[model samples]
Target: MNTVEWSDALLLDYEPMDTVHREFVDLLAAAQNASDAALPQTWAAVVAHTVRHFGHEDEWMQRTGFASADNHIMQHRVVLNLLREGLAMAQAGQMDPVREMAGELAAWFAKHTQTLDAALALHMRREPPPVATVHRPRGGRGAHASPG
Candidate 1:
């Protein structure tokens, strides 16, 4: 089961960008399922993907001049750096760092999706939906999975 799942509600309707966001949720689930001994490796992958994901969003924000881009990017930097730090500690044999970090990440994910990301999604939809190939979650609020 996924600890956090991506959905249309979290998207800005920017296909290219939404694809990256969905990948982030998928990666988050993969990291959560990794075993203790394999977690650091999984976390590193997660961290790399997260950086890429944030970068993509930043790029979109820059191109579109989203007013909240600065604030959103700042939040991304803070949370991602924290995840990277936790990964470092876990790699150094701290053992439980990613587990605690998972919970934190999940909380952050939910809040961001419901509030900040939601705003961006709404903004992106103001014009005709973008032409990039993107998939958004279908149906209602619970149509997509969330943290367990």
Candidate 2:
């Protein structure tokens, strides 16, 4: 049970996106509740899920001509970078920072979902894109498959 719960306020009314978001919340909570011995691994899981989660959203934004694609993707990059940094610190036997980052992410996610993601959901509803064109990119870590 992390600070960020999967409440209706977080739902975007878009099935695929909402499903991914719910998974993100679950993974995050798993990390937050893991024991000291499990923290690093749990945190890593969170990072991995987030990488994919953000990638999905980023792809959707790109496909839907989201007006704030640049800003939104930049935020994703920064957050992913920070999460990776936390993972590194955790691997080096420094868990406090990762814990703190989890809390910060809880706060940040609440706002991000409510605002940026909400707007994207609204746009998508108005102008739905073909599902086939939204694959994740390839190459490198968290790479998305090419858009079809």
Candidate 3:
């Protein structure tokens, strides 16, 4: 069996994030099942995707002023750092460490998605987007300047 499998519990109802999460699960499973020769590359792919994954979420949190942004971002940073370390370990011919980490990562991902990401997705769905009111020309005959 794979270390991680995609299920409804993993779905956040945020399509963008759900899609990324699916990719993460698949890549992690691939890493977990990879042979010695393919392990490093599989792990590397997971690391690369996670960098982008966390980055996009962090950016969204910042942009939307998510209430728990700081703590959520901290968790992402710490986890991503550990993942990067695992990638290095994989590259160094130490396969067992990263293999173990893959399992740990799956557990972490489950909780992280259920709590932090779910909250973020709910916040995103509930919160109104940033204000960018369209401006009409004065009297319909002059230039309009939009607020920054």
Candidate 4:
């Protein structure tokens, strides 16, 4: 199982998204590193953070009309559901699966960040290039630069 840590590579270059993602990384790491007695509490925090994090992105995608909004949001739904299932497994004394999920989640997040989140961040930060306007002479006829 691979353990992912917060690094510059994970930064999306967008502060709002980065802030939420940073919290996610911190919370997930806490859960992954928690003691057996503390696992449930820590894991619950992870679930909570994920719900808010994904919801935040969903709103951004909808508001900004991201080209892949449907696909991106669907991925979030799938992962969120999986995380919720992990929570239930933890409640049922299935710490191993929850632990396993932490590693898998970390791995998933790394790739998702690079692809989806990176693109979203770029889109959010993109600015339209300046357009130059050509002014026509008062008359409809084109002005002759030089008389024949």
lDDT of the structure predicted as candidate 4:
0.88
- The window of 10 residues in a row where model 1 has the poorest summed lDDT is 134-143
Per-residue alpha-carbon lDDT of candidate 1 for residues 7-27, written as tens digits (9 for 90 to 100): 666666656657777887787
lDDT of the candidates, in the order given:
0.78, 0.87, 0.91, 0.88
lDDT of 4 by residue, 13-132 (tens): 888889988899999989989887788889889999989899988988887788998999999999999999988888888899999999999999999999999998898888443367
Quote each prediction's TM-score: 0.74, 0.85, 0.85, 0.83
lDDT of 3: 0.91
Cα lDDT tens digits, model 2, 40-120, are: 999999999999999988998887778999999999999999999999988888888888889899989999999998988
In candidate 3, the residue pairs with backbone N, CA or C atoms under 3 Å apart (3 or more residues apart, or in different chains) clash, namely none
Question: What's the CA RMSD for each of the models?
Answer: 13.6, 8.6, 5.1, 11.9
Tell me the lDDT of model 4 at 130: 33
Q: How do the residues 1-148 of candidate 3 rate in per-residue lDDT, one tens digit apiece? A: 2279999998888888899999999999999999988999999999999999999999999998899999999999999999999999999999998988999999999999999999999888787766887677777755655678
Where model 2 places Cα greater than 4 Å from the true spot, the runs are 131-148
TM-score between model 4 and native: 0.83
Q: Order the candidate numbers by lDDT, best to worst.
A: 3, 4, 2, 1
Residue 11's C-alpha lDDT in candidate 3?
Answer: 88
Give residue 37's lDDT in candidate 3 (0 to 100). 84
